[model samples]
Target: MQLRIKPYNKNAFPLKALLIKGDSVRHWVSEIHALGLSLSEVDAYPVPGSSANTVFGCFVLLHSNKKLSDLRMHEQFQSVRDLLFIPSFSTLFPAMSEQELRKLFSSSKYFIHPETGLVELPEPIDWSELLIVPVEKCREIEKPQDAVFIPRNVDRFQIKAMPPEDALQEMEDQVFPKKKEFEDKPLNLFEKGKLLFYKLLFTGKEGKQGMFDGSDIKMPAWLSKLWPGFGGTWFDKMQEDFADLEERNKRKVDKLMEMLENDPEEALRYAIPIDPEGRGRGQIGNAALDFFTRRSNFSLFGTDGRSGSGYAVDLGDAMYDLQRQYIKTAEELKRKGDYEKAAFVYMKLLKNYVKAAETLEEGHKYNEAASIYLKHANNKTKAAQCYEKGNMTMEAIELYKELEANEKVGDLYLTINHRKEANIYFEKVATAHIDCARFLKASIVYRSKMNDPEAAQSVLLKGWRAHRDGNNCLRCYFDNIADTKELGREINAIYKNDVSEANVDNFLDVIRHEYKKKNELAENIREIAYEIIAARSQSDPSIVVTLKNFNENDKELLKDAVRFKLNNKGK
Candidate 1:
């Protein structure tokens, strides 16, 4: 069932229309169900004691007056429910002129491109000349069971005759109020219904006077019959009866919840036989248990007749309520400078040790926060940080050392102006890096952090000799060493006769490529590179040939090196 969805432009109309194949009956039913969910957005608000927050996905049937089900009466609500918000998050209505339908749902899906005239309708549709049929007859085309079955013809639909202009506008405004540029508008049907439904359904005031009271908004007769708030006639009486039943159920569930919290064995025993009132206490208790365990799928908007499910405990909503109260209490305590009480609420009640610690820290109770972090949160790093923040230098150092965070310990010692202690830990960090074969890291820490070039040189040379396969130490050694004579001697000793031809070639290539600038280090390295290349040429003549080829490619840079190589070609 390929359902082609066509969305109406807000300027023309604000509804989406789906054109589907005639044989796709299942998709039609599913779409209607989706639309029912959409209409429920009108009731979507944070309801007290109910955690099923609302999400909407609505659609309406056109020209069909039959109420599908008493539970699913939203289908017959299009005329009164003027504004429909679909799953696509766009507002739409059922009414549209034939021309508007043709312009949107035609064979060519293009129209005038916004800010450009690149795409448009092939020809201007003539609504007057074309044989206009009611939208009801659209199903009669090839497939009879489909909704909005548009054919290739562009002029098949004729707009359904509507109510008066002012009446329609008022209803539309009530359903989805238009926002004025500067003026504040009253809440619309969705907004009002959301708050009203939340209060009526979740606040345990089901059948109050103002409950289901939308006497101000005007709607059609059929809609008023199914709708609770519109006329307050038959549906209101039905709602009152449902409310009475629901209130009784709520009390029973509340008792069960209290029992479950205080006495688990008693709560389990409570799920027993029917009482004198003939109400199934067992069923109710089981439902509450399911809800307590967070396995309840019973939605308030459920069309199925599941009486006990609605009364089940909503743990999520209960948790949300507790959290909201915690926030309020925490804020009040903070204002009164009672941080210990606030932290207790976060730690003991909320089980949020991080938040508890944060609250203590915010109140300048850093030691208390650090203790909480260490004991409850089991966060050593945060404990160390809080200790440092509290000016507990010894405590911070101990935690950091336990965590093997030597750098942090060094930083803390420096904060206390203990240069000797700081350098000791910093050197430990450098040595640890070298032991891990992180020679470049060790050199950087020694040079940058420790401010000891000699120590940096010693580590780099150690790394180079231990891991000659790595080029980091070799590059760092040459890049830092300022003694040109010592640099040449080190280069000679490093790439000796016993070194593999590949390793010697790699060493010379590193010096030639890295030390290319016209500096004393570069010149000395290049001179040493020529000697290594000439010696390697004794075993492998291709070394000089490769250098000559490089000089041929770019004569300016490699000319001197290539000439030196050629003069000592066989040495």
Candidate 2:
């Protein structure tokens, strides 16, 4: 007899099942009875003969308000040969929009048949494929509640439940079964030596062994072999030894801390080992230094002098000591001909400018010394001196100019026989000083070294205009000239076109004064004097009265002047 089965509807029942199509329906009924679930507990539907051609059978556990993809399967049920499972759907489509649900059903590879109102796959699926609708597509369906499902207790029907003791035995057999007993292996020579070394290093009483624990202690393979077994006793002994050494170090640090409360400097001395031998046993010293240097609070000795706890030493004091040590180390490096290293320590660590510069200078490192002096010490003069000593003449000149030491700058140029450079600096000074002496020096340099008399004359001209006493400058110009006749001719040419009578008068006065100082011949002086008067008479007719007034002093001046005037007479 053939039984007609309708499509399963998830909304009509909480649980549903798909009947496996077989040769006889009685076989399936017996199998279901053999399992714990009864036929009434599940809503089973018969698979048509065409859909049951394969061994795989699909059973979908659906929820009214959830998607099949949302349900989580137990690990054991994740894959099965005959049972093709689909999870509940509420997690996939909880509160999904209506438009999204319509779009999902329209485009999904798995969809509910319109006629049957039942979900269907694209084709018949194998159980081993673990086929289900795609999670992403399922998430588009609209649902009101989260996806959930009651897991079936398949283990009760699939296999016999073992007793508690039998389960424990089975786990033990898989993980840690007993092994056959064997005799102990003998130790090799290297292993024996290692064991012996460890025993000797760790097994001794606290004060009995030498204080080599903190040093480069290692097990050597060449040591004599004297041990029997590698056991736990050695580790215990080593731990005890470490504890005792730690306690000793703690006591020493505490003692140093106490002394720091009273005499910090004395405590600092103990904190840094002085003797070479004491350096090897500096564990306590290092600890004490660290303890004081840190920011945490430390307890004092008793309540007599201090009641509250504070730092054993302030940061300032600690840094001061550290700086002193650094300076000492730098000095030692300097003494040992390690000047570069010493300078680094002085500059970077100690920040001692004087010492750093001195050390650099001692090593003939003048460039670095100049930099340190100029930048750190703010001593431009010293920096220039260093540059000069190093033969960095241009650098020294620049530095001297920065200091505005124009005289020193000129002197420096002169020392190097750089007369042109000297003249440059002298010109700057002359411009600043506006003195005849400075201009004279510049002119001398221009004449002697540069061999440019035109430049020298220009300098003199500038000096004459700059200085208040032009007469001194005029005398300097006269002294610079080689011939008195040429000097007279030059002076006549200079005053020939003088529009100002005062300027001509000043020129005459300068010539007269210069002549008086040298006691030059009267005729020579009269020649220059008459040339100026004759030129002045042409420009201004009033010079005759001045000439007459000048003739009153000497009768030779009048005769010579009359003859000079008559020689220049024209039609």
Candidate 3:
């Protein structure tokens, strides 16, 4: 039977199955919903079966909290023959074992009568009657045209079987045949004589000149019969060698004849006219240099040294003319691994101190590089970094200190195990942070590096009083408080001294959140909260109104304190 199956929107639920009933389309959506499972439903259709009968069914897409291997059909359903499990087209199926398939045929859950609390036992399903469709065949439901037919009532699903070991070997043999096996046939007299003749007259190997020189391999008589000009390779090699020798002799004779016919003055262009008395000083050396530079095609000479290249009357007056040559020379020296000389050329000739310093760094002359960076380039930061690279700690420390880089100075001192010196620099950094109202960073430095919690608290309190914006600092301080009585004192001091009519409500809200837990510490904090309410209530009558929606326990205590403080104010 042709069935029209299509992909549905429930791709998220990977475990899906079609419930087919040839009799009628029966939906157990409500029964499945009773198990509190997430399910998606699709339109009903006929299922291909063994009998020529129209089947009707809908698909139920679902995900089980249990693993796919552990999933089974709900046992409460009565019609076991109706369910047909298919792979989802939109979602990929993991491997399903035969046992998993059988378990899925078994029911998953018991149906309970919700109103009467009656349990309906599941009907058993025949495991043999269930169809085990391969996931690949089922997923073809994605293509509406090809999804029409799925074979049923088969003994086994048409899964692609792996080839047997011997079969695989036979296939491999056909694909990659073994080399020609050994065979023997005794030669007759004519064949044997012809083979011997060809071996003696025609065999040769290709020589270094790419001509066939000589070898023992026999040539076939057919090749000789096909081309009349194709003599054996040995004869060809001898002819080629003789021709080459004759060509060499002809070239030599032509060179001699041309030399005899030429003008003699042309030869003197490269010859030095020597004075027997040594009167012509530098002539021979100049002639050699001209030859050498000409052979180099003037690549070795600068423009100033090249023939017919004019220069300024005063060469020093136009220094820019020499700049390009200096740059090219420096680059050549750098490429040739002469970095020190390259640095010298950049510094003295080009006046490029940065390039000089970088070149010296490449040469690993860190001390000289650092000096050039500081004195010529005026980059003290880079100078300090260079000194540090060279392990010159003292020089780096001085430069960092001069630059007001206290953090680097401190780290440098710590590297040398000078803890006291490091702390001195760290204190400078912390003091600078405090001056800029960076109380959080200053507190961290004092607490973590200096190991002084009291100084940290003092800085946070100073910041709080000056700017009224150190809530984070205060929270950090309170989080580190381990001792209960010290916590009480700190809380009491903040409540009594830190409150103003404008900020008193804010402090109250902070205390309420900070000490919300019910414990002895919180009880003490609550009493302090009431004390602050009492003290502030005498001055600002509206403080009690702010405590209206406070924590129940603290609000009651604060209200009593406010009444007592107002009575005292009246007296």
Candidate 4:
């Protein structure tokens, strides 16, 4: 019975399998089919017990115990020689375990999936291992028309891997051979003097021979022969060159000083050059730098005044130019994403703390900005602002308190809904602003945020004490009171302990007006009014007769006046 085998396509499985040893070829073929692997027709064949010997175009199964050497001599096997070979382990080496077989073939490359019973060729067969049989005795074999032979180069394959460092050293040894080492000997005094003299001359303006046509100077040919050695003629020439350079530099220095007096800003343009690499142009460069430093009053290299030179010049213009240059350099550094270096230049060199802080803030470096503002700029308010902007509320509040900005402290506390802390700051604000009559703002904060009416009332009362018009302030307090009953009780308590007649009269009028407006009940008003009049009668004795005469026509008023006089008769 022929099994219904699926048609083969290279896209489904591009790899081909070559199976050897027919002893278990039937079982191996079944396993390969179960793995859904496509096999080349040239390499695959069906065994007797294999399911339905229907052959696909790719898989080739060889059912024979043929050695690789014997198979390579066959024309059919030659076409699929390059394809992957899978030989049954048991058939190839009887009584051998999988581990033993793998160890025996360790030098070769192969793949094995034990779970799927899948295997591939460990290595290509060695053609030289084949037997050399005579053509007359050998069986005739037909080769495929499209078969292509590929020759392997043994020398191209490396058996062992080389480490990178070892390979590099090997290449270096081949390219650069070792050479003898030479030691340097020190020069004598005359040779050293000649070297210094030549260096000075070469680096001087006169050394730039190319700059002037027909005015070039050259060392004598005999000097080259003697080279590093110095003699009387070389020494005289060196001294003459030194003297000429000195005179020229002195003239330049005089001109620079004149510019410093007339056009100081322009003098900055002609200031000494700073060679960052320290490649000095002999004595002139050093002398020019010293002159500029002294003129600018820079104490970095120590002033010449203490040395009795007293060559200090006005540094105002130079200092200004340096500050501007530093600011420009810092800005450029910031633009180049070098924030740390930029901050250092701004803080250490320029000392422009405000600009540094502003730059930090612009860069989203809030914590650093706050620190600079606090420590360097000494602006606590701005520091607190920075902290608050950065969502660092606790830090901001602490700074605000340190600055005595109580209102800001209270506002911050209130913003975070820390009512208890808000109330504490509000009370502080109320106390601080009491004399200024600004305590009411704190009272508003206390009432709205803390919901403490009594605290608010207490703050308002303290403010009213410091107010010039106590009567108007007291009236205003009553008008704005949250609870009218609470205000009435507070007023009753104040009036009961009163001793001054003028204050008593003011309280009486307020009570009367409040009673008329129904802000205070009739009974409480009457009691406070009696307390005020009795207190006033002690200072002015005619108060009793004036009240009796004024209320003579009103029965209730007359009765109340007599009751008041009788009640205060003991005092």
Candidate 5:
């Protein structure tokens, strides 16, 4: 099938493409029955666990989802579990809309974009519990493909050499056994033959070789002569093999002994099991000698199911656990102020933690271990720094906030949010009036540039408030004073000092009343109002009555003073 895959911008599953044997359906099914063991190349996450990144191939499986066996489940899940974490780490995954996630989950047999960290959807047409089965299947796609299926069951595909329909027909045709069509008949019988013997075998040091030891059956001279000489003595190879086996056993024995040390009396219970739990072994190699000799008669410890498989023993975990506790004890000693012993203990612990954490990463428990290390990180600030250095921003941000480093918080916000993200952390910046002023200054500039007068006014008001709060970061005080004076002058120009004295006095009274409540240049502002309402003291009864009775906006009769002066000069 030709398939197209669209990956999530992120995800949290084992998304892989796999193709197996393609020719005979029988072989494919056989491999599938064997837990798909032949296709080891695509088990990818736990380092080639079960995922494929290439396209174009086929596979067959014996069990579908309805009949998935334990072994088959294991083969699929081992890798599936390991790579599942890859999806959670995706930044893009969370950025997807809900609709995208639904689409991705509905498909299979796709490319997982390394960049997007998404597993693509399966092809449109498919049958069987193929999705749930521990089956061997082929995923075939274009050249330069993102993923390819391994070649185990690939040769078993029924459609390998023909069109889909023809292959299907061929498959159906092959199912019906050939009946009386062939011409040959079968022959069945048994026969016995006589044995040929060898005569006279030699003896005596460097002179010759002898025949076989006492069993009764004999061979012919030609057959015996055809036997090739075995290189080196058989004893040498046997001894070497024994030595290797012994060494391995010794190591296991040592491990067993160490394990018993944790609880000697109950050691036997763990060391020996009647039914042979496969893990129950009395001895290991020389390493576990004491456990073997003293603990129980069962010499082999930790086996494939009965005896021990050395590679499978969790020595790394054990040593790590041991060292971890040791370090903890040492840390307690140190916390009690015993610097030297604590240091020693800590060193031991560090080694153990390292080992433990490596296992964690392999077991796909990386985030957990990282969480611990993140907690035990040198110090809050130091750990935060480490996380940042390690590009673990998510972790760093979380812990750093606990350190209560507002400055650091500010820095991180500035670096990442770029001011536009004031929506998230505006309060943090709002803490410092000076900072607020700075923000408002920029905001005011932006507002004015956008021709948003109301926004500009708000920003200016914030800036003014900031200045009032003793945040004189930008010398906005002087500009504010200048504006107030200019406004006062404009109001004064709108009126003149020609009103009746009564009016000036009355306006001053209003000014004085307001000044008691707010004194922001109020006294000076009162003088301007006084001038607007004033009446010049003159011995002119006619103009006084004219201005006093006229409205505040009437022209002063003496407003013609300039004209009168010009005429007098001509006279």
Candidate 6:
């Protein structure tokens, strides 16, 4: 009837089901595991695959009966709501589905098994550190409609159901019954409304807490699918939590606000955790930091933008941290379609980037900036806003291009793929780039990435349009240029038409003539020397040529240092 299932580390959580001799449990365990839960051992009975016909059932993990988190998670076990979790399954067993087991191979929460569920797998444990880190959510996920190989959230990818609106509504409807079994309804309508409201928001159907409450409630997928506690989601209790955190933080902020008048040192001294509503990563605190910095600056110096010793200066660490967080959060927000906030946060990063770019080169400073931009691209709508702030956006995109971070840059492009604005800026940047390989790559991307060859060619043409259409000044400097003859004719035509810059052909002709003369001088040295002597002074470079010719008859000139031999080597 009750079970306790807890593991100190990632060890197996044994399963033991207390049932009659004919309880028919094996098929049941297999089904639950198939749905994605971990299973280890079972008590006295054989329940691995008991049923031949049945497809699914719960894996039974027993730990000295049942703990509250476990019991509350099940169908009708409500008695142990107050018990603390302990890991002794002497009379009970640990139960999990095959899917869960495969995803989390070891019964440990630290490493998730591949076939398991969707929570992002956390990094490995550091032996040097004692604390355990939670797994990160996987960026790679797919919905039913998405191509099997492609990640979800493309233009064609539909949204996955997370607690479909219907579930929330159905639970809501139950609160206001036509006629309740109880005689007393409420002392006041407002009170009744308040009670119903709290119930609807905090608990799911059958009084299930919609969140983790330090309890071991292994929520079934059926229920969790309805109340998704995934990344960046706002649950029913979020507002209430925001309210309470806000109240405590409010006084600190007010003090911080006042501190803005005189001491920013004191303002930052207020410490992190300033805003409760601010999830660990966000721009909320940056706004607070900006407020503090501006107030301090204004109070110290006149509003004319002059600084004095009296001005309160913040190290601006808070701003930096908040931006870093926002850089991460903004991307997440975009993915979730909280576009307004995501866009606003991205704008915040752009402003910071401007400030950062002032102190460092755009290329180097963009390293950090681009990371934030990456998350921005995870959601296209947010990227559209950032894309407009020319400098920051261009800098961000340049870094993305250099890295060839396709998953990111490609997706960002998807957002702006159809926009004229996107086309214009991309063309400008593509044209500025010297690598034709970049053009070729973009060409390849058209076919492979978004599956649009027209887009690829358009991108390539923009990149190579100027280079391919004309001979380069550098290339014309070389005599080996193949189009010299044609180019010269073009030059003559241009000259006849009174052109400003010389035509490519004329440049090539000059280069070619120089090469021709050099070749003749090398082959007909005597003639060149004769001509030189006839036209020039008593002794010139021609004299040297004559000496070299005479040297052929001197054996000494051929000796060691010379090609001619000495008297002993006279040949």
| Tens-digit lDDT string for candidate 3 (473-553) | 666666678887787788777867875666655566667766765556776666666676667776666565555434564
Cα lDDT computed for each candidate against the true fold: 0.51, 0.49, 0.51, 0.50, 0.36, 0.35
In model 1, the worst 10-residue window by lDDT is: 294-303
Instruction: Give one digit per residue, the lDDT tens place, for model 4 in 276-296.
Output: 222221243223223332222
Worst 10-residue lDDT window, candidate 2: 294-303
User: Who is ahead in TM-score, 4 or 6?
Assistant: 4
Clashing pairs in 3: 73-107, 73-108, 74-107, 74-108, 74-109, 75-107, 75-108, 75-109
lDDT of 1 by residue, 70-107 (tens): 33323122221322213232223445555665655566
Model 5 spans > 4 angstroms off = 1-373, 377-379, 389-391, 401-410, 413-423, 431-467, 470-474, 477-571
Taking the tens digit of each residue's C-alpha lDDT, what string does model 2 give over 1-571?
A: 2212233323222222333435444555555454444544543333333343533233322222222332222111111111222221212223334465455445322322222323434443232333243555444666679767766643221122233234323433542213222132223445435434444554434323423344433223332145434436664565455444444433444554455455443343333222212121123222212232221111111112222443222232444445556556667667778675566555543446777778878987676677677667788888788788777777788779988887678877776677777877666665664444466666665666456788777777666655434556566777777777777666665555431454556677766655564444445665666777777776554444445443456767567656656655551
lDDT against true structure, model 5: 0.36
State which candidate, 2 or 4, has the greater TM-score.
4
Which of 1 and 4 is the better model by lDDT? 1
lDDT, residue 368, model 4: 65
RMSD of 5: 42.0
* Clash counts for the predictions, in order: 9, 10, 8, 13, 60, 53
Better of 2 and 4 by lDDT: 4
**Best model per TM-score:** 1
Model 3: worst 10 consecutive residues (lDDT sum)? 292-301
